[model samples]
Target: MAVFKEIFSHCSDLVYRKIEIEGRQAYVIYLDGLIKTEDLQNHVIDEVLARKQVGQLSVEKVEEEIVTVSAVKDQSYLEDAANDILEGNAVLTIDGHNKGIVFSIPGYKTRGVSEPDSEAAIRGPREGFIESLRVNTSLVRRKIKTTNLKIESMKIGVQTQTNIGIAYIDGIVDKNVLKELKHRLDRIDIDGILETGYIEELIEDNSWSIFPQIQITERPDTAAANLLEGRVAIFVDGTPFVMILPSTFWQQFQASEDYYDRVYIAIFLRVLRLMFVAVALMLPAFYVAVTTYHQEMIPTNLLLSVAAARESIPFPAIVEAFIMELSFEALREAGVRLPKTIGQAVSILGALVIGTAAVEAGIVSAPMVIIVSLTGIASFTIPKFSLAIAIRLLRFPLMILASIFGLFGIVVGMVILLIHLCKLRSFGVPYFEPVAPLRFSELKDVFIRTPIWMQNSRPDDFVKENKKRQANDLKPSPNKNEG
Candidate 1:
């Protein structure tokens, strides 16, 4: 008791309950809020008090015979016992015994599993990961029941002692990628990790790059899908987002609904999203460049209208674009930070009122307003927020380039961006895979998602051993007799 008290000194929540077990003195130690009091009273205290055997009360004896809790273990050292108590497990210490019996009865309240606000789908499983690591793992396990689906657990932060789970399919996962991931994770020596974002920043291959090398998803089905595709999923305690590694550029454009919908519809949506990605990234820059430098490219009537709209405006096209883009970004961010109901209203109303006021005031042109609004809408079409953020960050630089050198500058900026993307790597896997490397077989899912039956193999870049995913020639056909 003296040593335990000294170890947890000044900790008001540390609880020590004294009990007499068959005339032997014992103490039950646990955190007050973490341990279930009712379970402690019935399972440990009542069970020990009810035991009337005349045998010696050792840690092993008490743990094996007296404790009714299903998960029980005996720890020889005080440090291990203290750690167990901190982990919400009850620790039992007897007068004569040197070891402490640990009982797993964590009862801290956690938010129930709910649909993730960030990633919502109309046709797939709505359940998303909660803050609990165990619950998240169970969700993935429910999807892939094979024994080869391995989940390796580790404690990361020194102060937080945060639980982290690395999940991957044994045979399908790349050994090199798995080894690299473990190496990076083992090298992390932070004081505390509050969320998966901390781990993401620490473990990612390129920290300087704005693009997210590791993809995060709150949906368990998304995690499971990645696991099946020979990618790794890292689950951090106390955060709903699970980090998926070896992420490619094309994967960000994909939504879970793609797999749930019809083949042609999925293909059409993928193509549409790709087209809008170009629009979101280049529309503002293109508008500024063409209106400022290349007036001949625009048809005569449209050019006249645009010139007429900007006739009263004082600022140049670039300045006008900058004003609208920055204002739109500010409003979008405000919408996110504010309350849900009011946030959407504020963003929409703010944009409409502000854009109209700016236009009527002749502070900005109507053409620039239309361009910025269209770009904002296009950005929202992206499935992954991280990718959308990357696009948003790159837009300003591209716009600046366009303002300086016109179309030539935009071209130069795009070439540089492409070079950077091509050079980037995610956990040793090429970030621009299939496209840059020119894997013709894997192109089916890049620009267009083919029928499920046609995708018979996993991405060869990630899975070296288990390349084949499904059997060949599974396409459907009507029976002759039925027809």
Candidate 2:
């Protein structure tokens, strides 16, 4: 008890209860907000106290008859006992013994699983991951009811002692990827990791690149699908988003809805998103370049209207684009930070009022507003928020380039960006796999959402031995008539 007190000194919520168990003096320690008191009292305390009434009992008898917790373990070290208590497990210590029994009963308030606010889908399971790591892991377990699904856990963050779980299939996952993931995780020497983002930044394939090497999702089906495809998932306690390893460039545009919806519609939507990503990257740059330097790129009447609009505006075309783009981005960030009820209203109203006032005040051209609005819309089409954020970061540099050298600068930026992407790798897998390498078989799944029956192989660079995903000749067809 003294050692336990020393370890958790100045913590007011540390609770201890003394009782005689089987004629031996015993004390149980736990955190107040962690364990469910009702379960502790009814399931454990009552039975142990009853055993004391029997007068004669042994450790074997106590183990056989008393504790109701299914996941009880003996802790020999004082540090282990203290750690278990902090993890919401009640430690029962007998007098004159250097050991304690730790009960697994983690109970505390957490957000309930619901629709993911960031990764909403039109046609897929609406359930999203919550802050509870156990609940999130169970969500994936329920989806993929295979014994091969393995979830290994480790504690990171020396001060915070944050729990991290790694999920992967045993035989299907590549051994090299799993070994690399464990090595990287073991190297994380942070003092605290409050969210999965911390782990992402710490263990990603590349820290310098703006493009995210790790894939994040709040949906269990998406995580389960990734696991089935032989990717590892890292679930950080107290965060809804789970990080999947070795994410490729094409995977960012692909959403969980692609597999849930009709193949044709999913393919069409995926293609549209691909186009929108390009637009998000280049729209404002194109607008700045054309209106500023290459007015001939625009037709005569449109150019006349653009010139007339700019005649009233005091700022240059590039400055006007900058003003509107930055304002829209500000509105977006404000919308995300504010409360949901007023957030949407605030962002919408702010953008409308600002854009209208800017144009009415002759600060920006009307055409610039339309182009900026379209660019924002295109950015929204990106399925992954991380990729959308990457696009947002890249836009400023591209805009600066366009403002200097016109369309040529945009082309140069694109070329450099493409080269950077090609040079990137995520855990030995090419970041631009199935594209720059041009694997014809993998292209079917990368560019387009092939029919499920036709997708017979797993994605490249993910699974080593289990390359075959499904049997061939499963495509549906009508039988021949006997006329």
Best by lDDT: 1
The C-alpha stretches of model 2 lying farther than 4 A from their native spots are 21-24, 53-57, 479-483
**Which digits, one per residue and each the tens of the lDDT, describe model 2 over residues 1-483?**
888888989999999888875556878899999998888888878888776454444344455567787888888999888888888899888776666888887778888789998899888899999999999999999999989999999999998999999999998899999999999999989899999888888888789999999999999999999998989999999999999988999999999989988989998999999999999999999888888789889999988998988898878877888888889999999999999999999999999999999889999888888998989999999999899989987988998999999999999999999999999999989999989777888888776888899889887689879888778889989999999
lDDT of 1 by residue, 365-427 (tens): 998999999999999999999999899889999999999999999999999999999999998
Clashing pairs in 1: none
TM-score of 2: 0.97
The TM-score of candidate 1 is: 0.98
In Å, residue 226's CA in model 2 sits off its true spot by 1.1
**Structural similarity to truth (TM-score) of each candidate:** 0.98, 0.97
